[model samples]
Target: MALLKRDFIPVSKQQNMKPLHYPDCIHLSERCGCDLLSISECKGESCSFCQSAAQQELSQREWLSILNTLGLEQQKKIAGKYYSGKMPWKSQQKKG
Candidate 1:
């Protein structure tokens, strides 16, 4: 399922211009519907939660949401190809 834009809370930047640090586990917590707060300190890398989220594929609805963020012309072009069955599939055979 695609998460709505409102699902994410707006993160504010600090006065020192340093970006807020997000725990590598936020994606895992997100699956459980946790409203995460911005953290200033993070545990070291090598987090399995982060790694899993990174490898997950976006759903069709999520892809549509992303396409909607593009300009109108670009959106039309992509949607055209998608609806016309011309969108490439990894295992599709190519003709000479």
Candidate 2:
């Protein structure tokens, strides 16, 4: 008899996949390196919406997900490139 525990209880239907349950498939790009991509590229510089043509850009969640798999130094480099521009983020905005 194996030592691995087996659940005799029937799995509940409530245990369904989340809306964002995307499998980790890897893709390599000259600009972004290896990424777990569903949609191909980032749209309108981090703008995400429903459309085929607008699906080129990576979503914000995808960017952050890719970042989590990266080293600190590489993360810094990527962040630098994106944030260096006129980012509309509140953090980049000056407080008066």
lDDT for each residue of candidate 1 in 1-96, tens digit (9 for 90 to 100): 222222344345543333333443434343223333343333324433342243344443355456556786775677577656333321221320
Model 1: runs farther than 4 Å from truth?
1-58, 85-96
Candidate 1 — what's its lDDT?
0.41
Collision pairs in model 2: 41-56, 41-57, 41-58, 42-57, 42-58, 43-57
Top of the candidates by TM-score: 2
Distance (Å) between predicted and true CA of 35, model 2?
Answer: 28
- Model 1 earns a TM-score of 0.25
Q: How many clashes (backbone N, Cα, C below 3 Å) per candidate? A: 0, 6
Structural similarity to truth (TM-score) of each candidate? 0.25, 0.27
Alpha-carbon shift of residue 91 in model 2 (angstroms): 9.4
* CA lDDT, every model vs. true structure: 0.41, 0.39
